[model samples]
Target: MSNLNSLQYFIPELFLIVAILVIIVVDLFLKKNKKIVSAYLAALTLVVTIFLAYQQYGYSPALLFKGMIVLDSFAIFFKIITALSTLIVIFISLPSFRTKAEYYVLLLIVTLGMFLMVEVNNLLMIIISMEMVGLISYVLVGFNKHDLKSSEASLKFMLYGATSTAVMAFGFSYIYGISGHLNLDVIQQSLIINQPQALPLFVAFMMVLAGLGYKIAMVPFHFWVPDVYEGAPTPITAFLSVGPKAAGLALLIRFLITLVAHPSAGNAANFIQNVSIHAPLLLAALAVATMTLGNLSALMQKNIKRMLGYSAIAHVGYMLMALVVFNNQGIIAVMFYIVVYLFMNFGAFCVVESLTDKLGSEKISAYTGLGYRAPFTAIAMAIFMFSLTGLPPFAGFIGKLYLFAAVINQSWYILALIGLLNSVISLYYYATVVKVMFLNRQENAPPLRVALYNKLLIGALLIPTLVLGLYWSPVINFTSRSIGFLFGK
Candidate 1:
C-alpha cells in the first residue's frame, strides 16, 4: 500500500503521538503541586488508545509505512496489553509517589515505543523501537532522584542496556551484509536461498538474542534485574516486569517465525531442518537456565521487589517453553499466558506497593502478622501468590497447563520435566511468603486498614485472577484469534 493509503490503518499510533505531545505541553503549564492532572490525562489517553486498537481487530493483516510496520491481530493485541498495563501502572503510581507530570509523560512515550516494538517488519525499525523503550526506561528507573540506590540502579541499567544494543547492532550489520536486505521477509528469503554458513549465522543470531534477552531479563543477561527492581519506584518496577517483557516476547516470536518453516507448509517433522541454525535447542537451553537461576535465587531474597523480580525471570522461562514447539498451539499458549500474567503479576505488585506505603519498608519481615492486621488485603495477596505459583484453581495454573501441554505434545519430555520441577520449587518460596503472613503472626501487632481506593483496586485485580481460573473461555478465544500474523492464515 502507498504511504497515504497506510494512514488509515495507522490512526491509533498517530493519535498516541499527538496525545504524548499534548501531555508534555499540558504539564509545562501546570504548577508543580497540580501535576496530578497530568496523571489523569495520561490515563484517559491510554483508555482512548485501547478502544482505537480494539477497533482494528479482525481486519486482515497488512504492512504499512512501506513495510516498516505491520497492522495485524498480533500487533493490535499487544498494543492493547501494553496500554492497559501502563494505565494500571498510573493508578499504581498515584497512591504512593509524589505526582509528577514528567513521569507520566515518559510512560506515555514508552507505551508508544512498545507499540512499535511488536509491529516492526524491518531491522531499522526494530532497533529504533527497542532503543526508544530502553532510553525512556533508564529515566523511569532513576526517577527517585533522592535515593542513592535508584541512581546506582539507573547507571547499571544504562551500562548494560548500551552494551547489549551495540552487540545487537553489530549482529544486524552482519545480517544485512550477508543477505543484502534490511526487511525481515527479504532477509529470510535470502538466507533460505543462499543457505549461509551455520557457525556465523548462529553467532550473529546469538548476539541479537543478547539484546532481546536483556529486555526480558533472561538469565546471563539478568544481572541488573534485582537491584533495578528493588531501587526503582514500585510502579515503574511493576511496569518493567510486565509491559516490556511482553513486548520482548512478541518480538522474539515474530523473529523466530520468520526463520523457521511456516506452519502451513505441512512438514512439521522437518521444521528445525528447514532453519539454518538450531534455534530450538538453543532456546530450550536458555529457558532451562533462566528458570533454574530465577527460582534458586528468589529463595534467598529478603526484599519483596527483588523476589518478585526473580519470579518475573522464571515466568519468562515458562513462556519460552511454549516457543519451543514453533506451532500455532505454542503461539496461542504464549498469548494466553501473557494475558493472565499481566493481571496476577500486577496485582501482586499492587499489594506490595500498598504495604510499602503503610510500613515504609519492602522487607519480607514487614509482612509479619498481616493476616490479622489486614485480613482483606492479606487474603487478596494470598490469592496472588498462589496464582503466581501456578497452583490449582487460579488463572496462572491454567496458563501453565496450556504451556506444558504444548511442550509435551511435541515430545519435549525433558523440557517439560524441568519446567514442572521449577514450578514445584517456586511453590516453596511463594508459600513461605504466605506462611509469614498468616502462620507467624507477631504478638501485639496492631490491626491495619487499607484505603478505600486501594481496596477497590485490589478487588478489581483479584476478581479476574479468580474468575479466569473457573471460566477462561473468553480470554482463550481472544488469544487464539490474536496470534494471526500478516504472513499466516
Candidate 2:
C-alpha cells in the first residue's frame, strides 16, 4: 500500500500525536490550581484511542507505512493493553498528583511511544520508538525533583539505558553491513540467501537481545530496576511493571519469529542442529538466571516496592520460558499470562500506593495490624498477595499453570521444574507481608480508614482476578486467535 493509503490504518497513532500536542497547549493556559483539567483531557484521549484500537479486532494483518509498521491482531491487542494501563494509572494517580501538567504530558508521550514500539517492523523504527520511551521514562523517574533517591534512580536508569542502546545500535550496524537491509523481514531473507558467518551473526543477535532484555528488566540487564521502582512515583512504578514490559515482550516475539524456523516446519530441528548458535538453549539459560536471581533477591527486601520490583523480574523469567518453546502454543501462553498479570500486579501496586498515602511509608512494618484497622483493605490485599504467589483459586495460578503446561508439552521438564520451585520460593516473601498485616498486632494501633474511591478500585480489580481463575476459557480463546502471526495468517 502507498504511504498515503496507509493513513487510514494509522488513525489511532495519528490521533495520539494530535492529542499529545493538544494536551501540551492546553496545559499552558491552565493555572496551577486547574491542572487537573489536563489530566482529564489525557484520560479522555486514551479512552478514545482504546475504542479506535478495539475496532481493529479481527481485521486481517497488514503492513502499513510502506511496511515500516504493522497493523494486525497482535498489535491491536497490545495497543489496548498499553492504553488501559495508562488510563488506570491516570485514575490512581489523580489523588496524588493534583496539579502536575507536565507529568501527565510526559505520560501521554510515553504511551504514544509504546504504541509505536509494538508495531515496529524496521530496525530504525525500533531504535526510534525505544529511545522515545527511554527518554520520557528517565524524566518520569525523577519527577520528584527535590528527592535525592529519585535523582539517583534517574541517573542509574539513564546510564544503563544509554549503554544498552549504543550496544544494540552497534549490532544493527553490523547486520546492515552484512545484509544491507534495515527491515527485519528483509534482513531475514538476506541472511538466508547470503549465509553469513556464524560467529558474527551470533554476536550481533546477542547484542540486540541485550537492549531488548534491558527494557523488559531481564537479569544482568536489570541492575536499575529496584532503585528506580522504589524511587519513582508509585503510579509510575505500577505502569512500568506492566506497560513497557509488555511492549518489549511483543517486540522480542516479533524479532525472534523473523529469525527462527517456524515450529511447524519439519526442518526446525535440522536448522538448530546445523547452526553453530543455539538460540533456544541460550534463552533457556537466561530464563533460569533471571528466575533464580529475582526470587532469591526478593527474599531479602524490606521495602515492599523493591520486593515487587524483583517479583516483576521473576515474572519476566516465566514469560521467557514460553518464548523458549518457540511455537504457536507458547506465544498464546505468553499473551494469556500477560493479560492475567496486568490486573494482579497493578492491583498489588494500588494497595501499596494507597497505604503509602495514608501511612507515609513503603516499609513492610507499616502494614502491621492492618487487618484490625481496615478489614476490607486488608482482605483485598491478602487476596492480591495470595494471587501473586500463584496459589489455587486466583488468576496468577491459572497464568502460571498455562506457562508450565506449555513448557512441559514441549518436553522442557527441567525448565518447568525450576519454575515451579521458584514459585514456591516466592511464597515466603509474599506471605511475610500477609502475616504482618493480619497476624501481627500492636497494642495502640489506630484504626485505618480507606477512601471510597480506593475501595471501589480495589474491588474492581479484585473481581477480575478471582473470576478469571474460575472461567478463563474466553480469554484463552481470544489469545489463541491472537497468535495468527505465528502461522502467517
lDDT of each: 0.88, 0.88
TM per candidate comes to 0.97, 0.97
TM-score of 1: 0.97
lDDT of residue 72 for candidate 2: 82
TM-score of 2: 0.97
lDDT of 2 by residue, 123-152 (tens): 999999999999999999899989898898
Writing each residue's lDDT as its tens digit, candidate 1 over 1-489 gives: 779999999888899999999989988888878889999999999999999999999999888978888888989999999999999999988876546888888999999999999998899899999999999999999999999999999999999999999998988887887788888877877866777777677777888899899999998899999999999988999999999999999998887766555535322354546346767787889999999999999999999999999999999999888888777788889889998899999999999988897877899888988999999999999999999999979999999999999999989999999999999999998898899899988899888878988888889999999988899999999987887563366
Number of the top-ranking candidate, with lDDT as the measure: 1
User: Worst ten-residue run, lDDT, model 2?
Assistant: 263-272
